[model samples]
Structures are given as C-alpha cells and as structure tokens.
Target: MTSISMAGTGSGLVLTASWQDTVPATLTVRAPGQGDGATPERPLVEVLTSRHGRDWAGPRYVATSVGQRLRYRSHELTSSGSWQTLSLTQTDAVTGLDVTSYLSIHDEHLAVRSWTSLYNNASEPVTLHAVSSLMFGDFGAADIDQMYLLRGRSDWLAEGRWSRERLRDAGLPDLTTPGRPFRTRGCIEASSLSSWPTAQELPTAVIGDDSTGTHWSFQIEHNGGWLWQVGEVPDGLYLALFGPTDEHHGWQLELLPGATFESVPVSLAIEGDGTLDAITGFRRASRAPGGGPGLPVVFNDYMNTVMGDPSADVLHPLIDAAADSGAEYFVIDAGWYADNGDWWDAVGEWQPSTRRFPGGIGEVLEHIRRRGMVPGLWLEPEVVGTNSPMALKLPDAAFLQRGGERVTEHGRYHLDFSSVQAVDHLNEVVDRLVNDLGVGYFKFDYNIRAGVGSDSVAASAGHGLLRHNLAYLAWIDSLRQRHPQLMLENCASGGMRQDFATVSRFDLQSTSDQEDLYAYAPIAASAPMLILPEQAANWAYPQPDMTDDAIAFTLCTAILGRLYLSGWLDKLSDDQRLMVAAAVRAHRELRDSIPHCLPFWPTGLPRWTDQWISLGLRDVGGDALYLTVWRRDTEPGQVDLTLPPAPDGMRWDYPSAVFPVESPLRIEGEPSGGTLRIVDVRGSHAARVVKLRSVPVE
Candidate 1:
C-alpha cells in the first residue's frame, strides 16, 4: 500500500488515505499520539444498491460491492480560521456513481463531522438500499476484548439511561484465531424506525479501549430513522453510522440519472481519558456557539401545574407568581386551543378558545407581558386531529397516506410537510401568533408516531417519510429566518426527538415528562451526556404541599441545566416560594457560564435505583465548577464524593439561607484533590448545589 495524500488539523488529528494497485483506496484517522502501526483502514464511503449487493453475506451493512469497487479519484483540503475541511471523492466504474465524503474539524477540538454525497451519472436508474454517512474500522484495533461499548436507552418518562458492556457482553464475540480466519456475520446494532428518533434508543454510542484509555464517541445527526452498528471484521472492529436502510427502516431510494443524494451527517470525537471526555469534545464541536437562546429561565404551565388544562383564570395568578420568581418566559401549554374540555381529538386550528378564555387568549398573553415576561404557547403542528374542522379543510395530499387512505395514529393524521399547502398553513398560523398574539416562544410538541411511513409519490414508504422529514426541517429553518428573535423549544412527548438534527436548530429541549421528582434525578443527571447542558430543559416542579427538602430536591434537579420551572407556584407556601426564588436566582447567576461548561459525573452515570447521583459542570477555562447532588430514598445520611482537584472555596450556592451551625448539613474537604464528605441529616429526598472556584496558585 502507498500513501496518496494526508491532511492534518491544528488539533493534532490526522486523516490519511492509502491505496494499493489492486485493492480499493482506504482512509484512516489518527489522534495526536496514535501511531499508524496497527490502525485498520476502510473505504471512504460504504454504499449498497439493489442490483449490486454485499460481497459477504450477513445481516450487517458492510462489504457492499459498490463500496469495494470505489476507486480514489481526487481530494481537496481547505482551511478557514480555526476550522479545516477535507473532501475526498471516489468513483465506481460499473455504476458511474461519484461519491464525495467530507470531514470537517475545529483546530481546538478533537472531533470531526462527516457526511457523504452521491451523484448517479449512470444512464440507468439505481436503487439504493443503504448508504453510510461515516464508516471506520479502527475501533478496537484488532483486540475486541479490550473494547467496551456504551449505549443509551430512552422512553417517554425514562430518558437517558446508559449502560456499558464489554464487546463479548455486547453480543460481538472474538472469532479470530491464529491458524484459522473467520469473520462474524452479526453485529451489535441500535436503530430508530419512526418519526421519534430517540423513542427507543439514543442515536449515540461510545467505543472505549479499556487497555489504552482511549474513547471514541459518535452520534447520527438525523431527525427521523437512523441506524448505527459495531461489528467484527477480519482485521479489527468497524463502526458504521447510517441514516436509514431498507432492512431496518423500509427505506429505498431510486436514484434517477443525473440525480444526487446526500446522506445525513454524523459527528465523531476521540479522547484519551474516559467516555465523558469524548462526549464533552463531541458536544463542543457539535453545539452552536453561545448555546442558542441565551439560557432563559422558562416557566411553563403544564407538567404538574396546569397539566395541559390552562385557562385565563388559572394562569393569571400563576403568571404573577412566576414573574415574581424571576421567570423570563411564561408559556401557556396545551388545551389553550380547545373550546371544550375534551381536546384530545379536536386539535388542528390553533386559535384561542372562546370557552376557556372568554376575554380572548390575547388578554392573558398581555397579562404575561405586563408581568414582565415573554409569552409562549404549546403547539403540536405535525398532526391534525381527525375530529378537527381542519381535517376536512386540508387536502388529502397534505397528509401522510398509505394505500390511498390517510394514515391515522392516536386519533390524528400526520401532516406531510412535503406539501406546500401544509407548510403555508403552518406559516400562516405562526405569523398570526407572532404578529397578533405577541408570542415570542413556542413549545413545539409532538405526541404521535407516524409508523413505517407514507407510501405516497415515492419508491418506498421510508423514502417518502425521509422527504417529509427533510421538508420539516427546512420549514423550521424558514421559520427561524422569518422570526429571528423567536425562541423555539423541541419536545416530542418529552425527549423522544432529542437528537442533534433538532437540538442544533432549536433553542431548548424538554428532557423528560417524568412527573415524580425523585424519579427525575437520573434523567436530569444523564441528560447532559447527549443534549447540551444549556439546552437541557429539566423540570423543577415544586408544589405547595411538598416538604422543604422535597422542594429543594426538585429545584436542584433543574439548577444544573435550563431551569424549566413548573408546579403551582401561586399556591406555594411563603417559605417554599422563597426556596424556589433562591433556586431561580442561583440559576440566573450561573446561566452565563452554563453554555461554556462541560459535564462530568463524580459518581458515574446514574442508575434508576441508585441512591445518590451527582452531575458536575466545569468551565472550559477551569475557572469555576458547580456540582448538584441528589440523595434519594434509603440513602445514608453521610456520603463521600471524589473530587477532581480542589478549588479555593467550596460553599453551598443554592437554598441561599444557611442552616443552623449544629445541623448535620455540612460539607468538608481539603483544597487539593481529595474526597468531600456531605452529611445531610434530612436523609432522603434531598438535594443541594455547591460551587467551587479555582484560583491561580502562586
């Protein structure tokens, strides 16, 4: 093999391409000190077509003939400021398809964003079964036993549950031998097949080499169907990230002559310490600068407060209480667009309800503004209820269909954004809300899953759905262009669609809908692993009837992220109200630093039954560190936490009022790297936020 060309970023990450006379060209990336002795290489892009299928038979998505026939054509490298981009083009003689793969990286970051574009120059049409956005083969470096795979599982109320297992434990066996050679046909895979990307599993994973202390993390940046897999090869282990496949998502695209298609983007990060370090770098490279919408303190009347039944009478007092508590935005959640109480099947027309708001919803919105807060409302724009009047009004072509009938799920028809009428209707609704009602924020919620896809004007149902998904994102981009100052919150029944494709565009993401405060601890602690800390909207619903410790526990859950306040604040007791206010103040004081801070867990990733969970945020410059600790039921009163190097001063930042000197609530530790002991005599259902400041050692 001969090295053709090499490109290196200022971050010390290098990409090298090598080719042999007979074998196809291959590309490999190396970290700062990673020597190229044992690194395995793979093709620039792996693609599968209907006519020419995989060379090796397996359920896996690799070894396609189209990928093997690709020959290196040319490459280009460009740089601008601190960012560098490398584009490598390849061609297949048999298919006459040109594949261009792009890799982008920041000078100061150890991560790369990758995607591929394919153009069909053939005279005949080619049906694509699968196309990988990114594929690499150096994950385990020929040693499968030394690798650990980490994946996250998510659901409606239980989101961000992560688990780590060895390669053998994760269903990939060591099939290599000294005398004989064989490759495994099976792989460890995770995929999403519906509109809710994260409905079952998060589109992120970490591959850690336990022997070398090196970690590699990657995430598929798609809002709809996606698939990622790790499998064993003859040389080593390979990881493939893809948008959708015919086998997994029923997606197939017929590429006509002179047509082009671009795969979804994926981000990869490499670090030498731990999985969290890799995730930190991934978030830094992927998240937008300044963290979207300035990390405002949002108070939405939904969760435990109004429960989707908001009325002017019920919101007036809550609006005043939220404003007094220092909430910057007040959101009137679901049921505001319904005239009658049974609003489940009558949705579609997003007008103010005459019965719920007799004086008009605009009056209530005005009251929110008068209380010194931006007014927002909840909207599920993708679905129109079957009983809604708009159902008859919208054309059949505007909705997802199958077998000449509209697809209905949960008593609603999924709107296909591929239709211009659908997009225009939504544009009118948004314009009216922003122009007339003065709504500055929108909590865009999605409550139904459009199963399989629409088989309308496409080769496959999944292809049609993918087109609609792209159109939906395009609509969001247009919306942002029109209302540049409007803040948008992404919510798919709480964290279902929580992927970078949406999170990178939206201002905030609802973490979960877990109503139990105690049960929400793990979700909040694990949220920053996938979603950016500033965009993670964890709910802190402190009710009037809760104990002081319970209220503090719930408030502490949200202080570390975007403080999404809820609960009946108007009905809270005086002391409880003060605690809530103190939490808000602490968040406001630290929100400026939240966007720049990377997350760390002292006690490891949280488990649902874990007694204690802690989430730490350290600024990029190492100037400030904040930690939130939650003690659940049955936990001991005293627990010691291992700290990273001690800072100058460590003090309780939230619940600003100090406790009695004799009380058992105390934290003691040294100013160096040591363990800190926390004694909370309150025993269970308690939480506290602590701040540590690092000073220069002279």
Candidate 2:
C-alpha cells in the first residue's frame, strides 16, 4: 500500500491517503497532535459510483480498485493570508475522469471548508449519480466505544431543538470485520428540499465520543436542497456531506468532455474538548469578514408586539418608546404594503398602503428617523402571492416551475432569481425601499417553501433548484453592493431558513418567532451553538401584563446575544420601562466585546422545560466572562451548576436586575471553584446577567 500525506497547518489537521493496486482509495484525517503515530481506521472522503452497479453501499463510498477504477492523481497546495487550501485529484483509469477535492482551512479557526469538482476527460458525456461535497474519517476508538450523534431540528415557532442519540442505539454498531466485506451501512441524513431550507431540520450535526471527549461537527453551507449524513462502515464511521442527489432529490449532472461540475460547500471541525468545542470552531470559521455595523439593539414590531399590523398612528408611539428605551433600530415588520387586512395573498407589489398611512409611508419612516433610531422595513423578496399582479405579469421562467407549471406553496410562488426578470424586479423593489425611503435596515423575511424544486432548463428538479440557489446568493450579494451601509436581518417566518449560507452574509438572524418567552428560552440558549452571539437576535418582548420576573426572563434572553426588543414599551409602567432601559444599556456596554468572545454553556444543551438555562460568552484571553442564567419553574430556588475552570482570580459581580425591586438578584458562589450557587434568584421565570472579571488573587 502507498500513502500520500498532506497537512493543513492553519486548521491543525493532517490528511493521509492510502491505496493499493487492488484496494479502494481511503483517506484518514487527524488533528496534528493526535494519536501515537497511528493511522485512522476509516476514510472520510468515500467515492462511490453507479457505473459498476454497486449501489447498495448507500450512495458515496471509498473508491475501491475492485469496484471502480479510481486512482490518486496529484495534489496542489496554496495559501493566501490566513487561508490555506489543499486540492487533491483522483482519476478513473477506465474513463479518464478526474475528480478534484478542495479543502480550505483557516489559521485561527479549527474548521475546514471543502468542495469537490468533477471533470470529464473522455470524449463522451459522463452522468454522475452522486458526489460527496465533504466527508470525515473516523476519529474515535473501536474497542472502548461510547459515542453519540447530535442532530438539530427546527420548526416555525419553536426552533433550535437539539437531540443526542447513542450510535449503537441508533442502529449503528461497531463491528469486528477482519476479512469480510461488510455492507452494513446505517446513515442519518437531514435534507431540506425547499425554499424554507431550515424549516424542518438544521443542516448541522455533531458526533462525539463520550469516553474521550472527542467531537466532530459538519454544517452544509447551501441555501436550498442539502443533505448531510453519518454512516457506519465496517472500517469505522464516515460522514458524507453534499447537495441534492439523484436518489433523494432527482438530481443528476451530465458532464460533457472537458466540462466540470462543482459540488456544494461544507464546513467541518473536530476537537478533543466537547461538542461545544466543535461549535466554537464553526463559529470562528463563520465570522463575517470586514466586520458588521456593530451589533445594534433593535426593537422589532412583530411577534407579540404589533403582530404585523402596523400603521403610522400605531408605530409613532412605539418608535418614540423604542428610542427612549435605548433601541438603535425600530423595525416595522410586515403588513405595511397591503391596503386590506388579508395581505398574505396580495404581496407582490411592494407599495405602502395609502389607506393605512394617509400621510404616506415615508412619514412613518421619517418618524422613526426623528426618534434617533434606524428605520427597517420587513420584506419577503423570494416569493410572490398567487393573487399578486406579478404572478400574472412576470414571465413563467421568472418563477420556480415543475414541468412547465408554476410551483406554489403556502399561497405563494417561489421566485427564480436565475431569471433576469426576477432579478430586475427584486432590484427595483430594494432600490425603491432603500433609495426612496432612506431605509438603512431591512428585515428580509421568507414565509414559504417550494418543495423538491423546479425542473425548468435543468436535467432534474434538484439541479434546477441548485441553479436558483446560486442565483439567489448572487442577488443578495448584489443588494449588499448597492446598499453598502445596509444592515440585513434574515428571517424565514422566524429562523426557518437559518443556515450558514444566509446567516454569514446577513448582519443578524432572528432566532425564533416564538411569542412565549418561557418556551423560547431553550431556543435562545441553544442559538449560539449554531450562530455567533453577535448575530443571534433573540426577542425580548415584555408585555405590559407580564410579571416582573417574566419580563426579566425575556429581557435576559435577548441581552446575551443581540437585543431584539419588542412589545409595547409606551404601555409599560415606569419601573418596567427602567428595567427595559437597563437591559438595553447592558447590551450596549457589552456589544463591542461580543464579537471577540466564544460561547460556552454550563448546563450543556438547554431543554424546552429546563428550569434553569445558562449561557456564557468568555473572552478569548480569559479577561472576562459575561453570563446569562434563567431560572424557571423548578423547585430549587438555587441551582448548583458546574462551569469551566475560570482564571486563577476571577470574581463575578451582580451588575443589574429587572425584578424583585429591592434585592433583585445575586450570586452566592465563586467561579474559581468551578461551581456557582446562584442564590436569591427569587421567583420563577426569572433571569439575570452577571459579569465576571479576573482580579488579583487574595
């Protein structure tokens, strides 16, 4: 057997490729310092093909010399700034087809972003049945095994549901195969074949070994149809990440001679610390370059606030109240374009309702500006209602279609940005909103899903959707280019489309549309696991009737991330308003530092009904730690929580509180001991944000 070795210094990973004249090409990866010079048993980048009728290996697999004639070609290494890339090519001896895999790694982030390309060298066209965009080799021991798979699920209101399952319990067992060809492959896949890409499940996963604290995570960076899976093979475990496939989404690509087909992009990370360690690496890789307009405190008038019914009369008071409560952006979300109440079905024309705003929509927008807050408007640019004029006026090619028929879902037709007419329409709308209205921010929302996808001008439905997805990303880039100072918030009926593809470009992401703050605690607490804290815009809508504890609970959820404020601030009592102001003030003080912090959850993943949830953002240098703890209806007035070991001389101080008026809240233990007893937490549904700083040992 021959071995080809490649190293990615920036990402601290080494790749080892092994193959023989009659064996499959296998790839094994290891953290630079891991193992005692031992090669990993399984290969992550498995190559499979339909040419040999070996379709039972469950899609992609390690290219075996016996099944398919694939051999390692050559590799190229390059570096620019902190990013390094290693590209390896494999050639099919029979067909002379070349497949190149590119892995890009960053110096500071422990993640690797990868994509693959297939080039047909033969004179005849080659049809590809499946291709893996990204993969991982096994990183766990086989003998003393206790590993689990972590998956993320999302929905309309309650998003960010993460669950863990033992690999063996999930029908994936570690077997002893010495000289047997084992086809016992069990795969766990999460696919989003719709416009609401993240509506059902998040394209994020984690596999961890409980005995060794080793974890690996991978997230697909596609806006449309995507698939990521964890499969157990006789050698060990393997992960395959890709876009739509022929078997799952009717996707196939025919590459003519010398033509190349590029696969989707995926980011992966492996660490020896915990699942959170892998998450931290992902967050680092996803950090937006050139930075963002500092995380602003926004007050959005939706979700238990205005509920999408906004008017000049209704928003004027809220704008003033938002500005007074220290909100920097007051976003008028949804229902602004309809002259009638049933606006959902008539949403094509992006025009302000004269009936609702007699003085013109610009009047309300100006009112927001006069209140010293940036004006943001809600827009769903990817879909047009079936009853809208655009549905009849625009060309059929401008919308997603299946077999020449328009694809409609939830009373809307998905826009095909690949169509020039669709792109022009979106540009016109955005120009009118930004140039004419002087809107500095936009709450871009998507509310529908185009199932499977369109088949127009493509080999299959999945390929058609993939084309539109690329076009959609280009459109977003164009919008940013036109409006350089624009701050965009991505929402899909509230985070149903929350993936790195959209989240990486937008300034903020609405964590959820959940109105009940108590139920939203888990979502907010777990959001940092998927997105950076600076971009996680959790809602803190404190209604007038909510108890002080409840109001504080909601406010606490927002402060840890971006403070997305709502509710009727003008209707609140004097004390309640002060409390809101305090939360905003606290966020403002910490906003500048949030981008430089890494998140850690002391209580692991939060459950929907978990009595107490803790989220901590620790500075990279161990200078300080900002912690948010929420105590719900559990019996224990005080919860003893174990935290990561703090610096030698760190002391937590009670900065502020929103409830109990006199003696609101305080911490009763030291973090230096690695355990904190949050005492005097008071009533149920209460929360507090504490700041811990390193002091001289005394």
Candidate 3:
C-alpha cells in the first residue's frame, strides 16, 4: 500500500517517478470534448509524463464539464507496476492531495515549463481597472508589469510599489476597448520584496493575480535560454496544461488550436526546492569566452563607417579610446555591411564590409581586444532594407509588404518571421557571427512594426510578438547554448521596446538615444524601478549650442548610478573624463552595496509649493541608510525626507549638508512618518548623496 503506484503501462505515461508515496484511493477521468462523440476516456494529449521523463507513464485527460475542476489519483484501483518521480508528481509528495488542478507540468522537447491559470469562469466579465493589480518585473523586473493595460487608462508606480493612474500611451489608440491584448501570462512568482531570506530559500507559496483578465502570457526567467509561459486556453479548470515552449531550433510557444476552449498550458511544479523540471540535451549553448556580467558600453562607435570612411583606422582610435575608458563593448554600427543607400548601401547586405575594414574585421577586433573591451555588432535580425542586396537576392514574398511597396520604416523592411525557412536563414546568420566571428554582443534593433495586409500576420496577438521576438531568442539561446557566455542588448529606437518582456529577454536597454530632456522623473523613477541606472540614456553628444553646465548636470545624473557613457567622451576635457571615471568607479563598487538608486535630486519645496523631495539608500548591511534631500528653488520652503524601513533597535545617525555647510541632522527614530526638514534652500541645488552609517545589533 505505497503512496505511489503506476497503472497499466509506462508508454502513454509521458513521465514517471521512482515509486515512493501512495496514489489517491479514487481516480476520476473526464473528456475534454464533452458532447461531439468524445469519449469518457481522457483525450490523447492528457497522458502525464513522470518527472523522470519517458521512463514512466501517466494519464491523458479531457474536461467533460468544460470549465469544471476535477481531481484523481492512483491507489488500489490504480495498478501496481507504476513508478513515480518526485519532480512530476501531481500528488502532494507528503499527503497526495491531487495538487494537479492547482499546477500542471508537462514535457515539451525534454524541458518542463509550468503554467498557472486563474479564471472567474462565472457568468460575466470583470474589468481589472486598478494599477496595484499588475505584474511588474524587469531584468529582474523590466516590462510593463501591468498587462498591456488600456493605453491611457490606469497608471502604475515604480515596479508596482505605489501607483497612480496612467493618462497616455506612446502607441496608437482605441480608448473605448476593454483590456488590450497581451495580459498576465505567468503564475504568481516569489515576492520581489528587496530582501533575500536565505541562499537556499525555496518557494513556499508563490502566486500571481489578475482580477482583470489581460494578456495571457507571463514568464519567470530561468536562465538565459529558457523561461515558463502559459499557452492559449479558454477560462477552464484542469484544462491547464504546461510544457516548456522549447527554444532549440527556433523560438516556439504552444499556440492553442481554436477548437479547444481549455488553456493548453499552465505553470506548475512538483518537487525540489521548487525549481523548473530538469532541462536536458541543451549542451550546444554558444559561448563568447571570458564570461562576465556582460559588455555595458557603446555600440557602433564608428562615425567614418557611417560616413563611408574607408580607413579601418577610423574605428581604431574610437575603439581604442572606448577600451581605455573602461567601456566594455563597441559596435561597428551601420556601414560595415557590404552594399548601397541613403541609410547605408548595405541595408540588404549581411556580409562584412571588406573594403571598409581594409585590414579585415579580425584586425579591428584584435585592436579592440588589445584595448581591453568586448565587441558588439548591430543587426536588425528581422528587418531588411528593400534596396539592399539581401532584398534583391531574396524572393519578393520573403518579406512583409503593403499595398504594393515594401511596407517599412527606419530605412528597412520587416522579415516574415512566420516562415520557418526564414528563421533557418537567420540562424545561419547568427552562427557565422557568434560562432565564427567571436562577436561577444549584439544591439538588435526593430525599426519597424508589421502593418496591415501582410501574410506574416500572427494567428494571435501574443503569438505575433512571440514570433517577432522568438527570432532573436532563438539566435541568442543558440549562442548561449553553444557558448553559454555572452551578452545581447535589445533596442527598438531607444526606449521604444523598454518593457519587462524585452528586458527579461536581453541584458541591456538603450533607453532612447535622444537627450533625456524629461530625464529627471523617468530616469529617477526608472533606475531602481526597472533597468539599472547605468543602462539609462546617461551621456550624450551635445549639439554645438548646448551649454557646458547642462552637459555637466547630465553627466552628474548619469554618474550617480550604473552610468552609460555615450557621445564624445574624447571631446570633453581631462577634467570631465576624470570626473566620470571617479563616478563610474564609485557606482561599480557601491551599486550592490547601496539600496534604492536616485537619478535626480528632488525639487526643494514646502508642502504644496511644487512638491517635496526624498532620496534614500539603505546599505547592503541593512544597518546604514543614506538620504539626499532637495528643496524647491526660489520659493522659500521646507522639505522633509521620510526614512525607509529598517531593522528594529538599530542605532542610526543623521547627517546633513545645507548651502555650503555640513552639519548633523536630528534622527527622530521613527519609521514611516520620519522626516528631515531644510528651510529656505535658496539658490541651493538639491544635489546630495551624503553618507549615514549604523550597524545592526544582533
């Protein structure tokens, strides 16, 4: 009378575990296609695979009641010869409560991805019209956490900490519609509360909620090559099935065949410290050697290449300069492709510009290596210019076209990702660059979106984006699988694609190449809110008339965090480089050690004058917290800095600097309501990141 037992055989049993626990006493089976001649027997796809993979057999199921939830188990009724593995158990390892309904696990290409689906399934529809109820996560939590909400409708706060309502959208509009396509697709994940419980902390009970039905896709990033996703399914119970979307040959997501009303896949787990099913056979991940966090610097640093400068030496100085300045990456930009055009004759070409690289790209790379930096190259991957060679060589139907002309923008045309053949072609392109060239990084840009009247139109909104991004994922995963070491930065006209989905898929965000005129609020909010501050549009090549002070302030804003130094670092004086160097070093060292990052000093002001300012950072030790305060200009006002959370009974110190004088500010010794006040900060900029120290007592 063991808890675990197998039935008839292990063939249809997709997966099985080595027997251990007792299966439930009673087993219930249902049909997914209820009325139209479907059987009482489970559907052909319901067969469960033991966590051990093909080694064991399980049951296949179909929902008889459509949206009804049911449970089953193996016991006296269930035969003996059955084996079970802990990883795929549908039953509780300890009590065997038939947790299958709450979770689903399946094998797709040997890797098991979990999917979790929640449904109101009762009568009417509900509008999740609130901001707090969104899923927000970036590199650690980057994309729009709140499923693609109605563009200008509700608003969201930093990583969903505290949010107001949103009033506009950067994309097109249809304001009257319900939840826009692409909502929550992931089950609730472990809380991102900024504090790690322990090194081996297992998920006790992680979950996701969407009172308002948005898009049905969410992914919890595992490694660089894999993630979990929910497949298309009608709002139903037990119909929730999940399988790893498999990133082997190319990007793939389980697209539900319309006939079924059940969600094909859902996120679930059975064993271990709650990890994804053991992934196997992916030993081919590509590597770029000298594995590190990744290259975090400039892309296409060649102006001559852009301007048709034939001398490879043109890039020599720039690459060499970037290398010396601690820049980790340098991209060759546009002109390297062999071709002709206003945008670059090489638009359709994917080959190296041998003439431009007079000494060969190998020599240019060797130079960069000598200077101590990684090399990143740019590729539209999914875009091709109509006038380029690849376009002429490729058949007309190979691209996404409009009325007559090739529908495109940003000087390029879209690749028909819907074709497997197209994907294969791109794969070959990736292999040559990543494996053959030893290129360490890429700046993948999507300059145009697929407009109407294209055969490349996706079957589903989610699938459309899925296929579009899938191409890149496949290339990167293949590289990672083969190399297991490298970085891929995703860019779409700067911050255009700066959402969590894209961020989670890549390592960096371009955050727009334009000068951050409204840099204060967004970057200030974005630094700790999403991508690292260093990835923000930090440094820029100013126009001739821009003042030096503006550049200095911009530089200062950038230096305060993970700085991204673009523009002409060479054009600036030695003082500028030294200042940036010090800032970069300080940030690199203090990044993890500091708590919240502040991109801009707050505007000093009394209660209602303009607004109050508060910037605080908790030391990694949790005992110390540093706060920088700002007072509004002109108007005489007192601004308060409310202290952040801290461990109880920890002795803390308060220090302050006001208009040329540094002094000690009083610590009120409170939590939420605590405040630091400064009066009449006239002509005094709210610039401060001073230190405050304390050690927590055990």
- Candidate with best TM-score: 1
Q: Which stretches of candidate 1 lie over 4 Å from their true place?
A: 1-10, 140-142, 278-293, 635-637, 645-665, 696-698
Candidate 1 global TM-score? 0.95
Report, for every candidate in turn, its global Cα lDDT versus the true structure: 0.83, 0.76, 0.38
Q: Rank the candidates by TM-score, best first.
A: 1, 2, 3
| Candidate 3, 1-698: lDDT as tens digits | 22232221312212222222332211121112111221112211221111211111211122212112222333222211222222222332221112222121222212222322222233332211000101111011112233221111001111112122221131212233365552222221121110011001111111222222211222232211222211111221112222212221122322222211112221222211111111111000111232345234443452212333324766776665566566766776655665232444246556777776767787887777777777767777777776677777666555655444555655667666555645666777767887777788776765555532242353323333334444545555565666556666666544444433345456555544444422342333333333333344333332223344344334344433434555455555665555445545544545554323322223321122233344444553445555444333545455555544345765445553211133222223323334445554343333334445553644
Measured by C-alpha RMSD in angstroms, how accurate is candidate 1?
2.7
Best by lDDT: 1
lDDT of 2 at 408: 90
- Between the candidate structures 1 and 2, which one is better when assessed by TM-score? 1
Model 2 misplaced regions, further than 4 Å:
1-12, 15-26, 40-68, 140-144, 174-183, 278-282, 290-292, 634-636, 648-666, 680-683
After best superposition, candidate 1 residue 628: deviation in angstroms? 0.6
**How would you encode candidate 2's per-residue C-alpha lDDT over 57-118 as one tens digit per residue?**
44444442312455677777887877778787777766557878787776665667888888
Deviation from native of the Cα of residue 495 in model 2, angstroms: 1.8
Candidate 1 lDDT by residue in tens digits, 1-698: 66643344456777666766566667677777777765465676789999988999988888889999988777788877677777888889999999888888776677778899999989999899899898888653536788888899998999999999998999997677788878668999999968999989889888888888888888999999999989887777889999988998999999999999999999888876654565565665665443235788999999987997888899999999999999999999999999767998889989889889999999999999999999999999999999999999999999988887888999999999999878988999999999999999999999998887899878899988898898998899888888888889999999899988888888889999999999999999999877888889999999988988788888889998899999999999888888888889888888888878888887888988888798888776657777888887654577676556545564322222221112224676543445556777666677888777665554
